[model samples]
Target: MQNDWEWFNNNPEIKKLMQHTATQGYYFILYYMYYVSSASSVYAGLAFGAPIMDMILPLNETREKIPSFPTNYGIDGEKYFILLGIHGFIVNAMAMAWLWTTDAFIIMMVYHCSSLFNIVGVLLQQLNMKNCNYDEQYEKKIITEAIIVHKYAIEFAEFIEKSVTKVYGFIFMVNMIMMSITGFYAVLNFEKRKSEAIRMALFTVSQGIHLFLNTIPSQCIINSSESVFHAVYNCKWDELSIKSKNLLNIMLTRSSRPYTLTAGKFYPVNFENFGNIIKTSLSYLTVLNSMQ
Candidate 1:
């Protein structure tokens, strides 16, 4: 992993990619934080009859709005409510931190793996026989490095697949359900409860974004892997020595099969599948609305 990090750090193109990904990740986290805070405020308002804006202020009113414990527990005093509020706030903060950290980790892995494939593609595309000093040795070295990086990328992606398949699968299923239910509710309450409908709509959109974050990087890996074949084919391989030609052939064969990330070892995670998931969710939402 350290070697891989070194390789990534040394590559200017990969560095740019990482920078762009980091910027996007930053905004994603900000959006998540906003959503969580807004949802928490709305929940507090519903639970304790506090004004939503007032809930944003850390004061006695907010403390009073903390979720009520059982009266039988003998901890319902005003002083205890302050402690309860602090404890609840800490717990929520921890849970949100864990959630975002796990998501960011998964996204970072996927982006790195995709970037490796892209780097290999760039290397293959840069292969040139027309250069005055080009030789079989140079060709062999470049192709070998590309092949090695390609292999590393495949291994990394497989590791990611093995590690996150169950988690992604579960999230995928839950997101689908959440989207369907929330979308239905959003539409159902649009006339009667505008604020609640907007909240439901935002929740549905959040689920969609989460699914996109998972699948889009997987699609990038697929696209980058496929680019390898095109890069190899477009390169001046015919001018190479027989041994170099053989190496190109090996790479061609290997690159022909694009690596993929899967959910539950069942669905290939990609833009196409992402669209299908949305369609299926909407279909379910329609059915649910009709049943209601």
Candidate 2:
């Protein structure tokens, strides 16, 4: 995997692609951090008797006191509140750090794997029949290099799938439950607690975004992998020698199968499954709402 990355970076074209990917990733992480920070601030404000927004007033009115300590504990003072607020802020920051690192790492790997497939596709598509006919050695070398890179890309994707299976599966389940509960609370409190309702709504949306982050990359992998087949097919393979044609056959066979990632080896992580998650969460929300 390390050598594969080194090879990817060594190519100027791949380096450019990686640079663009890195730029996009930078902005994505920035926006997500800002969003999570705002949410954390709002939550901290509500719990620590600090008002970050005027809309929080309605929510604060419902609370008898700041949740710094249990009433029976009798720890009631501005100093205690401040201390607890500081502690809570530190804890939230740590949690956000963990979330950002884990999710960002997974997203980065997915993007790279997708880019690898795309790179292979582009290389295959650039193959010229005239050049291949004139220079058999050149043809063989180019095809061999593409095959190796394609194989490495596939192996890298498999490694990622194995590593992230449990993590994505757990996240999938948690996000579904969070989306359902938050959606239910958002709707249930819409009239009486507008602020709380909005918070819950945001939580639901965040979960949706989280699920999208996982599924979209998996979809990209599928799309790029399939494109490899098209790339190989579109090339003028008929003019190549028998050995070269045989090599192309190998690529065609392998690229015919779209690469995929799964959650818990059960649900395929793709756009279709993403929609199903939303629908399933909504169904659960409806059931909860009915019970209420």
Of the candidates shown, which would achieve the greatest lDDT relative to the real structure?
A: 2
lDDT of 1 by residue, 1-292 (tens): 5577676788787677656755665665566667655655444334343344465755554432425222433665454655565466566566657776787677667766766777777777657636777887888888899999888888898898898889878989999999999899999999986666776787688779778867866786788788888888887766778998888899899889888888899988989889999999999999999998
The lDDT of each candidate is 0.74, 0.76
Mark the 10 consecutive residues where model 1 has the least summed lDDT.
Answer: 63-72
**Number of clashes found in candidate 1:** 0
Model 2, 132-233: lDDT tens digits are 346667778878988987998899889988988888899999999999998998999899877667767876887798788667668877987888898889
Sequence-dependent TM-score of model 2 = 0.83
Model 1 error, position 161 (Å): 0.9
Global local distance difference test of model 1: 0.74
* TM-score attained by model 1: 0.76
